[model samples]
Target: MKAFDQLYQKHYPTVFRVAVKMLGDSDEAADVVQEVFLTLFQTMEKGMVVEYPLSWLYRTTLNKCIDKQKYNGRFQKLETAPEGQVEFQSIEKQETRIRVQRALGKLKPVERALAVMYSESLSYKEMAEATGIRFSSVGKTLSRTLKKLEAELKNKKYELY
Candidate 1:
């Protein structure tokens, strides 16, 4: 329990962020994060060794978010988590985030997660370990996802520049 506390404290924010990036809704992201932690707790209670704890958490979070997204039957418009009283540096920054998220919403859930992590600059090796994607495919998949996202944005006149 003590160790779980420390682990949750360290990783919860990352899980929550990934969930939001994948699902585009803070409300749903919160639920997915809770589900991930609950699963972790249960798995640990069964004495399972988490080979790579962070990777496990990320993969689990992505799985739960995909499940939730499927259950909801539709995508929600992306919005900031609204973690009470947080301020954006500028309206331009906020708009950019929103536009990118809108483009992301058009992707399949796995692609959205990969694309978001790519935008965050995670290495292909890290993404592969976390998501169980082939390390070699990560680059090709990301390139395709990004090109698709770019085309979608272009249709909406939201230039990445």
Candidate 2:
């Protein structure tokens, strides 16, 4: 119990940020994090030993994000460009964001997950472990997914030029 509490305290912020970055909603991110901890507590109660808590948390958070997106039918919504003071000459940024989100929406769920994990700088091994995919497939899957996304983005009509 004490150890679990310490783990939660130390890792909660990282978990929440990962969720938010993946899901694009602070409220949903919070929900995902809460669900993850709740599940962890249940597993611990069952005497299950987690060898890698961080990896477990990250994987769970990603799964929760996928589930939430599917449930809300918002899997297609690209995360809005970071909100803050940024100089922009026009609505190009917003249009680009929309275009990207639409293209992301076109990807199958697994491809979307792969792209997100890859973009987050997760290594192939880490991505495979987190996604429960083969380590050898991670590199190829990510490469294909990126190419698909780039192709989709380029083919879209949202040109800033």
Candidate 3:
């Protein structure tokens, strides 16, 4: 219990961020994060040791987000802001973020997951382990996925600066 709490404290924010990046809605992301932690808790209760908990968490979160996206249809447009808070980002920055997210949405689920993992600065090894891609293919696959994302952005006239 103590160990699980500590792990949750350490990793919850990362999992949630990944979920939001993948799912586009904070509410949906929060639900997915809850589901991931619940799965972990159940696994622990079953006396199964997750050798790499962070990797396991990432894998599970990404998988859940992909499944949710499939079940819900296309990735929904993210709300510009939460109610009642002044939007502080420069207009250019906000536009860039929205453009990039739209490009990300154009990718297949696995490709989007790879791109998100890359954005998170995950290593090829970590990405492979988390996404179940072959270690040798992670770099190649990510390179192609990134090119695909770039093409999607360019098609939308969203230059990457």
Candidate 4:
């Protein structure tokens, strides 16, 4: 119990950020967080030791986000960073966020998860562990997913510059 609380305190922000990026809605992201913690608690109660709890959290969060998106059938409207988490950005930054969100919506859920992982600066090894992709394939898959996202943004006249 104490250990789980500590773990949640340390990792909650990271998990929430990933969920927000994947789901594009803080409310939905909050729901994902709740589900994630519940799963973790249940697993612990069953005496199943998670070899790598951070990886498990990331993997679970990504999977839950994918499930929520599939169930909802569309990405919710994009907004600036979650309230109080980030200071207000300039209009250009906000617009860019919106464009990126829309472009991300076009990606398959796995690709979107890969992109979020990449953006978080997670190493290829960590990404592969969290995403269950072959380690050697992480770089190639991420490159392709990024290219696809760039193409989507460009098609909408959102220049990379």
Candidate 5:
């Protein structure tokens, strides 16, 4: 119990951030985080020993985000307007974040999960173990996911400049 609490404290922020990035809403992200922790607690109660708790938490959060997106169909629209048009500069930052989140939404759930894990510096082996996929597939999936994201961003007129 103490160990689980420590683990939750250590990893909750990262989990919530990832969830927010995936879901694009703080409220939904908070729900996903809570659900992830609750599920973790249930699994632990059932005597499930996760080999890599961080990876497990990340994968769970990613899955939860994907599930929510699927059920809500929130990814159908791409809200892309110039950030500068917003009244506040802070809204500009938010717009940029939303653009990125919308791009991420276009990816398949597995692809999104792989991209998130890779972006977070998780190695192929770690991703494989966490996602139950082959290590060799991780590189290819990540490459394809990146290409898809690039194409989506281009279509949305979100240029780097």
Candidate 6:
């Protein structure tokens, strides 16, 4: 109990930020944080040996965020599809955010997760550790993923946003 509380205090902000960045929703991010802590408590209760709890939490958060996107695909599309008319979000900052989100949607789940982590300035080693990908391949994979995302954003036409 005390250990879990200490873990939560140390990592809650980062976990919540990762969730919000991936899912783009405050409520859902909060839910992910709660779920992660609950799972941690349950696993510890079962006496599992977690060698690296922070890495485990990162992996779990990414998985849950991806699953949430999968489950809410339709709702997400409906929310971000710009409807028939563009709202007042044509201003540069909001427009760029929407464009980025759209491009992210087109990426594979792993790519999306990696890209978001990269955007948050996580090191390649950290990303690889969290994702279980080969450490040496993290840089190459992230570069390739970024190139793909850039191409997608370009192909979608910069004028639309």
Leading candidate by TM-score: 3
lDDT for each candidate structure:
0.79, 0.78, 0.85, 0.86, 0.77, 0.80
Quick one: RMSD of model 2?
A: 3.7
Candidate 4 residue pairs in backbone clash: none
TM-score, candidate number 1: 0.84
Return the TM-score for candidate 2, rounded to 2 decimals. 0.75
**Model 2: ten consecutive residues of lowest lDDT:** 77-86
Q: Is candidate 2 or candidate 6 better by lDDT?
A: 6
lDDT of 1 by residue, 1-161 (tens): 88789899999988888888888777778888998999999988898878788888888888787788788776764534345423745767666666777788788887888887786678899889767789999999989988999987776553544
* Stretches > 4 Å off in candidate 2: 74-100, 155-161
lDDT of 6 by residue, 62-149 (tens): 9998888889863275235343344655666566666777777778888888998887788887799888889999889899999998
Candidate 1 regions exceeding 4 Å error are 79-89, 158-161
TM-score, candidate 5, is 0.81
Q: Say which prediction, candidate 1 or candidate 5, comes out ahead on lDDT.
A: 1
The TM-scores, one per candidate, come to: 0.84, 0.75, 0.89, 0.88, 0.81, 0.80
lDDT of 3 by residue, 1-161 (tens): 87789889999999999998887777788999999999999998888999999999999999999999889877764433222232777767666667777788888888899999999999989899888899999989999999998998787563545
The lDDT-based order of candidates, best leading, equals: 4, 3, 6, 1, 2, 5
Tell me the TM-score of model 4.
0.88
Report how far residue 110 has shifted in candidate 1, in Å: 1.7
Candidate 2, residue 104: CA error in Å? 3.1
What are the per-residue Cα lDDT tens digits for candidate 2 across 1-161?
98799999999988887776566557778888999999999999899999999889878888888888889887533545544422462577667765666677678767777777776677888888888889988888888899999998997754535
Better of 2 and 3 by TM-score: 3
Q: How much is 130 displaced in model 5, in angstroms?
A: 3.2
What's the distance in Å from true for residue 136, model 5? 0.5
